[model samples]
Target: MGSQSIESGPIPACELMPASILISWHPPTTADVTVETVPPEVVEGENVLLLINSLPKNIVALAWYKGVHNMSHVLALYSLKYDISVTGLAHSGRETMYRNGSLLIQNFTRKDNGFYTLRTINSRGEYVSKTTTHVQVYTTLWMCEHPSISGKLTVESVPPSVAEGASVMLLVHHLPPNLLGFSWYRGVFLSEVREVSRYTMPLNLSMRAPAHSGRETLYSNGSLLLQNVTWKDIGFYTLQTLTTDLKNEVLHVQLEVETSFSTCCNSLTSAPVMIERVPRNVAVGGSILLLVHNAPDLQTFSWYKSMEKIDKFKIAEYSRAMNSMTWGPEQTRRQKVYTNGSMLLQDVTEKDAGFYTLQTLSRDLKIEVTRVQLHVYKPVRNPFIQATSNIVAVQSSVVITCFSQDTGISVHWFFNNQTLQLTKSMKLSPTKCRLTIDPVRREDAGDYQCEASNPISSKKSMPLSLIVLAF
Candidate 1:
């Protein structure tokens, strides 16, 4: 068999070229393959290197010797260098490596995890394999994925309230390579890792709140839990993660709690009222409660247009303990109108008017129920504005799209509110909320709004204002 010139520095073309890389014409009747270790078993802070064959006849693979890692599991890595007889050597993050059937060792790192596996395949079906290596790094290090704690955690360093004298259970989830010991901190300063009577998988720490104590215990898992929590248990706690391979990652834990019998203006107290649109072309109509669950004693029931209640549905009473609400004034006159904090008029005609609001009395505060605008029959979807490029000149195709968060959006192209004549550029693609404008001119730049709705609700997105600037 013949051979080719081997280059140094850059990886040779053979190793990375796939199946063809191992193909050598000279079939091995019998060949000698040797594996050697450069620096052998390593300690921290060291570099190791090794050489393959002297003759070097298409050397296929180089790898590391392996052993048990983390006292569990086996892993193999291959990153062989096939340059100038050097090939098939893998790296474990600048540490131990398997190079060309030779063991190449280096300084130990915390990330030198798992066992090492190296494989080699020659063109003639000859291959070498090495597996089973143990990796030992120093120190326990951990990090929380995304727990932002840059600025102030709480208002100030005011000690958070605790359970006065209850057991304060603190937990920390650790994923350390060489997890050793850990310490706790209150605020940013180092505090002792309180030894609790209970111990869990990660770290379970507990302590009795010192009477009127203004201290919050920080854990290794980057979390803070205040037990027997009180007003004083209000400040911020910091959890610092320590490891041998890296600097500590400090995480902030903010503590907050709402007192019982609290009052809120618009959150949780209100029902979920959402506009469900089909495609701006195909619309469906319906209505949902504005306020979900609030004070049971909903004494005043009112509907308003703008800010004034329509007085259409007389006052109603709701009782949470009673598990029901009473809205009187017979469901008459408006057939499609339902008084459940929201009223939907189906098969909506252009005559359908403006926004309606529902208000109720709860938690001692008179909060409006929900609001909805009765839109006339109109369809709108996503609007597409296409030009030659960002620098759109005259004679550009402008497409307006109409999409309904609700349904049945019959698109009506409007220049302002007045309808525009349907031209070739203003073609209507039925059931689709897409609009197209072509042969654009500076004159075509104006206010264009898409109206999308379903049988249930009608809505409009912010109008698109076309701006054409001459360069």
Candidate 2:
């Protein structure tokens, strides 16, 4: 045996190549042939290459068998002497053999999976070596329906309503034994449908689509699991199942996700109650709502301006049973309590930026209290940037100040329409309202703007051009 190099031709762009394997041949004694699948496992409709390694010298012919090393199941045969190749009985027109004794299977299907044997023949026309390997074929993405089944396939959620950050499973009911595959979709409409995942029963494999959030799991039983669900997940989900008989079944299930709250116990009663906060940041002269959720069956609920004694700071009160409302000493026409326990505050001012408490008294005399924090900020006015000099030489110092009429507002500087990046030579004042560059470089020359913002609103000034001389 001499040193021989076997190179493969250009593979199709769609084919996925497996890890490279090194092959070396020494003095020819006994043929030590080994066959391996480039990728032992492949998805249906993909190409798979069977690599033959450690070829012995004087190899006259190479033949491939589909299973059990039977001649009837031969896939392809290659004769090195005549430089000819031919397909065998088991050939499904998808198998191709390279001159180097390797085999390529195009559009591999489930029927092509299982044991494949490669047999090497010597110049004497005797089978020198036979190597076998196993290949796994997974199903591809597909959906079909024949509607031959009698009953309807339904999907049910483990819990009808799920809390935020909790996991839920959409279980399939009355699943047929002849199920071929199932797919989960996000929306009800076909035009706007977004596939979550698809599972094939024969392959016992699941494939995720572009809409997968990395929090979903598909089970073989045609169930889908979603973890750490959020408000955005509170919508309708559709499941479509395909059976072996070409029967199709579809079901839709709705999931509701709600925000959770801490439970508080009252000294007067042992019953625990939940309190929810609806924090709001309203601008001056704007209306705001201080909302409450999961309020107990109450006789009356009071909204107070502060957490002080309810009698002194009470803003308004509403009785659920009587369906009537009463104004407190601090309550004005602008402040009103709704029958649902939410309080609406109109024309809010800076003085309203404080904590407000909600005290509820149940019909059984149980008390539950919750607090909400309100922020009343003045709408930020447009800010302008003032520089010591619009034109400066490189390495010169420059001072730029951002000014806004609104107090308690944050100022941000932008360079060329982007957030300014502070260099080592740049410094900001304690309030960050002023920027000073001790040694401005040529790159610093650009348009600059200042933005002033409060919690409620923000405004940006027109661009100010700065020219820096390079020389």
Candidate 3:
């Protein structure tokens, strides 16, 4: 037989290299990227920047996502080479990207509260790094002061129930005119107690403890604003005020921070047979635990979607003996019945914005029923303002209209990042969406923005700078 010539186009590159050499080769390690909030905690109607740190040099592109690390929630994409940014489906026009891969959110609102993911891409369009950070947007609650006897200092805790993660104000009522300074203590006034903060009248300056949590604010009016309170904050707080003459007045107020799971009752007679929503304020697409507080040992319990206790509206029923659940025809997968007679509703929609009834039958043959109103609100969208003109002469009238697509929303105006105060010459339309300034003044030459808000969320428009030409 003649030798056969077997031909191949070319020998594979891997065949030219030893298998041992290939095993020694490894890909370059990517740097770890992290995101930080510039000011840490941000309040509503403010601006915050998501600062990116330790970004890899190979990263040529950056993208920001809203909730999860999903492309559909992309807010904006920035290209380092082009130095340009493109908005995505989730863009609200309030997000701006910088060359350093940082993102700036203007007019931040509660709707902006959640996790934000940053993805970095290399020149080859491969993901080099991804990091996520949570942003919490807080809402400031103004305290209402009631008059106390003059010259007598008093401390009043606002809202009664100081829920965790909620803000509380310890308002000082009947503040004496001759007040010199004040100090707030975490516990009752003691030499070894932790001093939250202190203010001095002479210096007009406030000093906080080195270990202060940065959540306490001592106001000029001698009030203390506590933000994002936790269970550990529950205790007696003492406020000591000193007069210019060196006389001191001490007062104490106890703070009871409520948690998601509250005590049923101290005594059987004091047991509360009521239903409460874990989160008092719930928005659409949110979950709520319709917790039954201090209900007697229940033999059976039923939950109705409507205020009426009719059987037709029943959504779920549970039996203690059988440890089983019976779902009604109206029940959906979103409804869950707990053994403790409580119900959890998830992914709530506008249709669930009504009253809910809970009926329980105890083993003692006593029946207890309670109803709670669930206001599931749709978050208000970002509003825009349209003015008659950007420039107005003194003594000329200018009408500004705010447009919002959400119903059941209230419109508010902000000037220079503060609530707009209406003057005698300023008139608002019936819906408060239209503001007419009969005569413009130089003071109105600053930025103006309109905020549309519901109980659930709020959003402000881009600032519209008004130029008032002096006549």
Judging by lDDT against the true structure, name the best candidate: 3
User: How far is 7's C-alpha from truth in model 3 (Å)?
Assistant: 77
In model 1, where is the ten-residue run with the lowest total lDDT?
138-147
TM-score against native, each model: 0.20, 0.42, 0.45
Candidate 3: stretches off by over 4 Å: 1-266
Which clashing pairs does model 2 show?
Answer: none
In model 1, the Cα lDDT at residue 270 comes to: 41
lDDT of 1 by residue, 182-275 (tens): 4334433344442211112244444332221444444443334445654333323445555556545544443322332123223544432222
Q: Which stretches of candidate 1 lie over 4 Å from their true place?
A: 1-297, 310-344, 363-370, 379-471
| Winning model by TM-score | 3
* Candidate 3 local lDDT, 1-471, one digit each (tens): 111111221322232212232123223344365566766546689999988766788666667889853556767766666555666667787888777879999999989888887777665445666666667665442101111222356676786568778999998867777878888887554443488888888788998964358998888889999999876576567888899888888877766567533453455654546666778768889999987867758899988987568889999889989988898867999988888888888999989877677888887878876666676887777876756556567887777767665665678899999999998889997558878898888788888899888767999989988878774
- Please give the TM-score that candidate 2 achieves against the real structure: 0.42
Ranking by lDDT: 3, 2, 1
- The ten-residue window of minimal lDDT in model 2 covers 13-22
How does model 3 score by TM-score?
0.45
